[model samples]
Target: MPGPDLLSSQGLRLDGRRPNELRRIKCKLGVFTQPDGSAYLEQGNTKVLAAVYGPHQAAKSKSSTDGVVVNCQYSTATFSTGERKNRPRGDRKSQEMSMHLRQALTAAIKTELYPRSQIDIYVEVLQADGGAYCAGVNAATLALIDAGIPLRAYACACSASMAWRAGQPEPLLDVGHVEEAAGGVVLTVAALPNTGSIALLEMSHRLHMDYFDVVLSRAMQGCRDIEIILDRAVRDHLAEGWTKQDIVTI
Candidate 1:
């Protein structure tokens, strides 16, 4: 079976976006007071929250003298998806997500600046329509910035899928849950959009070798577009947070 249609007659996705357009992104930093840093991110229907704690000492076993140790925990709310009733974390799927989150974040942080220290990041998915992991990575990057951590550049993630439009292969950006469940090949990329260096690349299914480059490029371009949104959010956050209070003499 070719499966359900992922595109409209007008060349829009199920979510009504152009082939290369990303879902709406909105983010805020310092969403919590307890954690060293916190952030919330929304990408279409997917929502993620991230908290960062510690540049504190690492356990001797996990400590590294060459760079900072990065630890990540990934969890999804029980009601995050349509299906309910299950554990949220410590499961096989969560464990795998944790490792992938760590990989993308470690690449952005200037770990060399904090040798023998540890930075712990936790990500929670509040809702998922698609690209939960990508939202997680972007949220963690903002949390790191709010924590005053040094970074070579911001880390951003995006996904791409192929759809048939006018009988031509059209690369879709920011695959949603529907497209993801459609059995299409989904290519996910995490990268430093400024430097255009990939931190992580993953594919859910096989794609033709001939069309592989086009799909990958679309995902990377999505990452870059996401970076622009995130950077603006950070700057706006700084402006609001660092405002100077006027003092008057009585």
Candidate 2:
């Protein structure tokens, strides 16, 4: 559904990125002292903050015997977008995003290692250029790591959109707000790329079967690319000493 203008004649996107390029990502861990873990991430203009608490005692009703419970809350600041949205807490969209966050995070956590405990993750969208959910997922992953939580693998998320360039089809990585607003088909994927497994996948608007595989692969590739960046950040943090507790701006 994207207009022809989505891609220029030079095969560059509206944001001047190549089809396979990702927006520059900058992130920091240990952003706050209060939370057991906290991180801030910015992917292009989309910014998100994530905090993690617990693996502590869970309420009787919500306690799980088989594995640790994962509770997630996703919120958006009123000023995050160009238009202010004075929505109440637990709005339908926020609740849905919270659920999606839990789904993707649970896949990476070693839940069975801590039964009858709960891990609470809170993510707030500070800016919403596009792909807020994906940014939240990436930020939460860093927060969990900051908390020293064990994991099966890194959980990463990315999105792709289909566009037409010079009469041929193209897949766009890291869809920006402009591209998202163009009414094009967007596919979002969360995965454990190291383990070769998918955590969550969502799409807005229908896309043809012929184009589905390519779009999905592109998103997966983005995840793999992001994981490397995150790993390097963690390594740098370790080298600097986690006890130093400085905000790592990478």
Candidate 3:
């Protein structure tokens, strides 16, 4: 449960947003030409980049006759967190995050379309302020789209936190690091918002069953909001053209 001090008397959270408000989202697609597809997304203080590769032949161990295999890797920059980390990858936490990312994205991708092929999606967190996982999911979704990989629907992720203010249960959408560290149950959901299908649902700490619906609903709304932001970014990037410079004779 969250303490009263976490919420201001003016009915605003620490970051000055209403309980259901999400952080600002800014994103760009096809940011790197080197990769098959690449995207960068910023969710408040969190920043993430995702790159997608293939629909090509699968690796020996991962090949499958039934469908394409989706391989995912999640890594964070050394300066991403408040505390500096030594290595970028191969750590226990990174390994676990990579596996979870694979599971969530695999559920949304249309794997059967390319049998014996593989699609690789890698996410790098350049800055973290909580909800890094959600940002990675959104960035990966855009990268996959840029890569021309077929997906059933846009996969998005958002987090919700339970806060009690004045003895009232309030669910906060898109928790930041401060809110997350405030000792409350954080519910992270990855879903296909358009289809109303959930791909992943993870909750930390504990919350009463009665408040679950409200918190889950808030997270779903955040996902929908994020999808709109990402869509706009893709369109904007396309409209901007190749370079910031204008060609032609001065």
Candidate 4:
């Protein structure tokens, strides 16, 4: 159970969104020329930049004969949040986030095709209002595509939270910072919506079993919606004749 005042009398969230609405997502691919692929994405106030390098030779210690190695590094800028603390990239939290990122991305990548190779993905959070991990996953997916990596399907991520409106349990989609801070159950999901598969699922706080399905379903729906948005962005990028070497913006 969360704080009772999560929703307004009219059933709107703190950011004036309905229970099933996602924040506006704006993204651009090929934002940089140095990396093989790069992208910048914004989900409301949350912004992330991702860069992907190689399918090049892997170091002996980290190389795998059976498949390509996917290495990820997740970091938050010093000023990303209001706290403005000097957060080290090798800290425990960043390491965990990096592992989670690698898991979600490896699920989409066709690693078997590039055996004995290595791919590096670096994600940096420029701003975080909530759902920063999800944003990082989304941005990294685009960067991988820009790098011309093969994937089983698009990797999309979204989050959900539980709240009540009109005496009925309502699942909030694409939770923002305010809702997250309200002390409710927050569920984050990363999925391949086109393939009907989930890559990762995480939750903060306990939720009733009865409401669990509903929340999960809502998060999946959000992933599906995000997939559409990302697909459109890809199409538009192609239509604009974007090349990985070209400097472009959208």
Candidate 5:
């Protein structure tokens, strides 16, 4: 079988985004009432939900003397992808994703302030068009913010892939599932965009040294873009609640 055609004749990706363009990211915070904080995010076709619970007492084995313990869980619904998955979390893939999610969130969280305590983060993918890890990180960040947790900066993530256009290498930003299925090298980066610092980086395959810089740069740019959108959503969420309260009467 032939592989997917990732790039179009016009140099656009299969999903109609330009090589440097990211898929639309829409998100909302406080989506769940049960959790201390929660958020839902949609990046193109991929959808994810994140909930945070804690700053509570930590188990003796897990407690840290100088910082809070960060626990993360990543799962994909059985119907999230084209293939029906029998389970969500027991698989090795989910396990690896869980560690990566922890890496990203831990960097943004102010763990030192809550010593001997712990924070629980749970992320679930409702749809997986591509870049599930990146979407999960973004959602988790929003959930953390909704929980009123302090952090050095907002953590965000994005994915990039390389494609050829007229014999010239072009780095694609925020790859979709179709591009992902093409078996190309994919670079995923999680970063504290406001601080211009990376928290974690992963790749599907080895990439040539010459192309690595460009691809990683594209992914970083995508992260910054995602941060801007998330920041706006947070501001809007705050404004909505503020508008309802007549502060003058209080």
Candidate 6:
């Protein structure tokens, strides 16, 4: 059976926002200095951290002549989800996610610029409310920027869901786990928002072809919104110049 009506008669969602509304986004770049680059991002209750390393020579087996090799690893913290994860990495699920992350990021990076070199990106999910993959992608994008990697555009990802309530078809932006678990159709998209190019798209459940356009558009909008938030965070981090404050006396 369908879950509780996701949209009330007042046109507000369970989180008390309009259908196109997105949750609050908080992000920080260069969160870890030990890595070449790193960033932390939080979207609603979902939190993710990403670290980037290299642009250096690839290991013996992974080297390529035509383009740079991008190695990616995705792992979830043991306590990230409601149910604890026993391992942080090497699991089948993490392995698959790592592949997907590599695929998505390769599309945005200008790999040919660093032929025979390599870039390593590692993403860790600190909290998983929903849209963990999307959050990871966004965080990794920022970390790449902090690492000074050239890219075609800012890569962003977001999720959308269809909530038909009161005979109206409403699209939810940036779905949370509660909304995702409701059995509604979910459409996830990773895109270069500035260029309006889609890098990855996946759909869960079923929705009429007519609704595809609406849901896809909503997800794209969410991606664009997320890009703005990330851009602002990057700028803020640069402006702040070391979050730690210490008195200086001459």
Candidate with top lDDT is 4
Write one digit per residue (lDDT tens) for candidate 1, span 1-250: 1322677889888878899999999999988877888899999999999999989999899999999999999999999999993999999989999999999999999999989999999999999888999999999999999888999999999999988777777889999998899889889899999888999999978777888899899999999899999999999988885411111111
Worst 10 residues of 3 by lDDT: 241-250
Ranking according to lDDT, highest score first: 4, 2, 1, 5, 6, 3
Put down candidate 2 lDDT per residue, 1-250, tens digits, no spaces.
5567888899998999999999999998888887888889999999999999988999899998999999999999989999998972488999999999999999999999999999999999999999999999999999999999999999999999999887888899999999999999999999999998999999998798998999999999999999999898888777878632443432
> In model 3, which regions exceed 4 Å deviation?
240-250
User: Comparing 5 and 6 by TM-score, which wins?
Assistant: 5
Clashes counted in candidate 1 amount to: 0
Model 1, position 68: C-alpha lDDT score? 99
Model 6 over residues 220-239: C-alpha lDDT tens digits? 99999998888888888778
Residues 123-213 of candidate 3: C-alpha lDDT, one tens digit per residue: 9999999999999999999999888788898899999988777788888899999988887888999999989989999998988899999
Compared to the true structure, candidate 1 yields what TM-score? 0.94
Q: Identify the candidate with maximal TM-score.
A: 4
- Residue 180 of model 2 has an lDDT of 94
Better of 1 and 6 by TM-score: 1
Q: List TM-score per model, in order.
A: 0.94, 0.96, 0.93, 0.97, 0.94, 0.93
The candidate with the higher lDDT, 3 or 5, is 5
Model 6, residue 162: distance off in Å is 0.4
lDDT of each: 0.90, 0.92, 0.88, 0.93, 0.90, 0.89
- True lDDT of residue 19, candidate 2: 95
RMSD score of candidate 4 (Å):
2.1
